[model samples]
Target: MKAKLGMSPIAWWNDDLVELSDDVSLEECLRQSRSAGFTGMEMGRRFPSDPEVMLPILKEADVTLCGGWFSGTLVNEELAANKDRIEPMIELFRAVGAPCIVYGEVGRSIQGDRSAPLAQKARLDDDEMKAYARKLTEFGEWCAERGMPLSYHHHMAAVVETEDELDAFMNHSGAGIPLLLDVGHLVFGGGDAMRAIDKYHARINHVHVKDLRLDVINGLDRTKQSFLDAVALGAFTVPGDGSLDFEPLVKRLAEHGYEGWFVVEAEQDPKANPPLKMAEVGYKELMRIMTAAGYTVETQGFPRG
Candidate 1:
């Protein structure tokens, strides 16, 4: 199961905090991503909604549109309304030939709220958990009907942040819904990333390979700081620059036959970290780890069901 490597545009320009890298152009982002050795990238706020407008730019840089983040409010909104909002993004992905759409359940999420503490993030009760999972399953099925698989992102400050929360969601959610295992978030949220892969490997169809700085994470007061606050403080970084050990996770993914995009996604200040340099570092480190794990890093071809 060969995997393709991709980078997220959040490294160049953060979606939540537009002020970070607001001056960087979409062309420069794509160009620097390609130059850093990533063949593809996830969509960003700077990207055009129209595929015809975006595809030409991507083609010029010789990069593929791997996927894009879709904010889902399934827990609060009606399924029909959620579907209606997502249909256009789904169409855009289909037009650009993206393999999947990354779904982040942002209903009542405080990840973006600088004043809201991380520890006080909203969580669902047992019954609410089951209902949310059911809605997620239905949405996943709807996406599948349109040739796009839904990869659920267990994001920070979301309802499904912790390991037990992730477990409940995965167990209750139907098999049609796939998990997008993000190593950095799992570790940052005080969960074992490798253990998660071991338990949920079969359901994981997409991957986000950001690394965490444990020193910064250990010092953070979850009761006072939000997820966005942590990002501003440099709690996350590319693979080699952080405290995470990627070899074991990479080897496990290869051994389990996990195939898809392993995107390097570190939400940080571009001025401080330098997007192009950090991207190259991430690309090289991941390649080294994957090679050591006896997996060939394929630079072409998207994963298919």
Candidate 2:
């Protein structure tokens, strides 16, 4: 049960805010990730879709393609329609040997609406929750049939953001549907990350080890600022540089026999926090926590030269 370390390109180039690092090339992102000691990296918007083109670049950097975010609208759209949107990405992930597809429900989400208040984000009632869970389960099974697992990402400003909502989804969803436990989003959404790991340990197939700047978070006016606004204000950072403690949470995951990609994702302005430096900070902190927890940090695909 060796755990592998990976990183998100968001720290370097934000997919939501394309202007963050519009000039940074895809080659540079992969290079910086590998140089920062990440053996794997999740795909970004700039990444080539053709496997023949992307695989070679990945091989040159010696980094594995972990996966990328997939915005799902199952809460409002039909499963068949959503399948059409997800199937192509599934094919790409399967071709590249990725482990799972990170699914974030964005139907009626205000995360990207900078002018929209966070408190006005969408939410589902009990009946709507059950319906959404059923649709998610069906989609998860569809992915499993295609050789990829669907990892549900609970995000801020989305319908399923709070701990109670997360619990309801898990309780109602089929056993096949797995969770993508994202620590920073959980905290930002007013949920306990450690408690989530402990409670949903058995169903968590993917992990996003993002840390939050609590001082900034505490000072946020939810009625005025949106999730995107928070990101612009430097709300997220590498695990060690932020306020959240990862040691106990890491240990808890290890104790629960969780072995998967622990991706470091901090969506920040690259000018304020250099991507390479922040990548190093995240890699070092994750390695330290994993090592202290008695989990082997696998570096199999990393380039030596």
Best-matching candidate per TM-score: 2
Q: Please, what is the TM-score per model?
A: 0.97, 0.97
Clashing pairs in 2: none
lDDT of 1 by residue, 1-305 (tens): 57788999999888778766647888998889888888888999989999889888888888889888998999788899989999999899999889899999889999889899999999899999999999999999999999888899998899999999999998899888999999999988889999999999999999999999899889999989888889888999999999999999989988898977889999888988899999989999988988898877776533333
Candidate 1's displacement at residue 36, Å, is 1.2
Q: How far out, in Å, is residue 39 in model 2?
A: 0.7
lDDT of 1: 0.89
What are the C-alpha RMSDs, in order, of all predicted structures?
2.0, 1.7
lDDT tens string, model 2, 1-305?
68999998888888778666646788888889888888899988888888888888888888999879898999989988989988889989888888888998989999888889999998899999998999899899988998989899999999989999999999999867899999999999899888898889999999999999999999999999988889888899998899999999999999999998999989888888898999989888888999999899887763444
* Cα lDDT for residue 43, candidate 2: 84
